[model samples]
Target: MTVALMWEARAVAGRGADLLAWARAQHLAGTPLRRETFRAPQDRVLVITWWDAAYDADLPELPEPDGTLVGRPVHRWRFEAVD
Candidate 1:
């Protein structure tokens, strides 16, 4: 089964673009089958990556962007397809 990993972060006031740029340059250890990014209200950036790995497998994730650019620590979640 394939799993999707979601990572999200909120940029500091007026720094959303910088945060997005930083995320775009990230390089995870494994190549994802698919990847996407979104911009949300309140200066948030959401990144979802599809990988051919188990939900519980240890995988390399993007490191947090510089503290000055984010309002808080990054959040992450893992999900397996149900359909």
Candidate 2:
């Protein structure tokens, strides 16, 4: 099965670039299949990750920045292959 995990996080003051860099490093370390970022009108950042079973097994816990702003909440969606 394939799973797409959508993680929404608020960009902390002076931390947006750092957060993005960390995410990029994680992707390069083989954590997720593909990663994409989107910005809302309110400046909220949304990150989407696509992963397979293997990728899921290698998933890592996200880092939390001290005194950083967080998004409304975290949400996830799962999908399976159909034929």
In terms of lDDT, model 2 sits at: 0.55
User: How do the residues 1-83 of candidate 1 rate in per-residue lDDT, one tens digit apiece?
Assistant: 78989999999999989889999889888899999999988889999999888889887787888899999999999999887
lDDT of 1 at 16: 89
lDDT score of residue 76 within candidate 1: 96
lDDT of 2 by residue, 4-82 (tens): 6666555555566655655445434456666787765443556777767643454543444334544344444444445
List the candidates' TM-scores in order.
Answer: 0.94, 0.54
In angstroms, how far off is 13's CA in candidate 2? 7.4
Clashing residue pairs found in predicted model 1: none
lDDT of each: 0.90, 0.55
Worst 10-residue lDDT window for candidate 2 reads: 65-74
Top candidate (lDDT): 1
